[model samples]
Target: MITLLIIAAALVGIIFGVAAILPNDGYGHRPVPRSHVDSYPTHNPFL
Candidate 1:
């Protein structure tokens, strides 16, 4: 029973983790992939 409970809790955590990072659909919403972060200028004063 304890093992089953642990597995259930882990599954819930995984679901929440995925939801936390997923992007929402709306105006002005831009999703930048990890591969593109390095392409941005680091010396920009606005950053």
Candidate 2:
């Protein structure tokens, strides 16, 4: 029926929209660390 077709199309759109928004971090990817520290260090040693 026309109703069934509309439901199917809506589901497909939701799936594609979610996929586009999510991050694509792949397997075994390591995050890079900051290259340099803050120029003016905080007075609090705990920081």
Candidate 3:
């Protein structure tokens, strides 16, 4: 019984972790993609 409880707790924790991290892919609110910002020109293109 104790083993079963431990397994259940682990499963719940994993679920919560996955849920928290799964929304980062443009979940309809985050501004510009980070990839683009990181690759942007070093010097201001306008200058």
Please give the range of 10 consecutive residues that has the lowest summed lDDT in model 1.
Answer: 38-47
Candidates' C-alpha lDDT:
0.46, 0.42, 0.46
Candidate 3 lDDT over residue span 1-47, tens digit each = 99999888777666544533555423444334443223333322221
lDDT of 2 by residue, 10-46 (tens): 7766654453344521223322234111332322222
TM-score for every candidate vs. truth?
A: 0.49, 0.49, 0.48
Task: List candidate 2 stretches off by more than 4 Å.
Answer: 25-47
User: For candidate 2, what is the TM-score?
Assistant: 0.49
How do the residues 1-47 of candidate 1 rate in per-residue lDDT, one tens digit apiece?
99999888777666544533556212234435543223433322212
Q: Give per-residue lDDT, candidate 3, residue 32.
A: 48
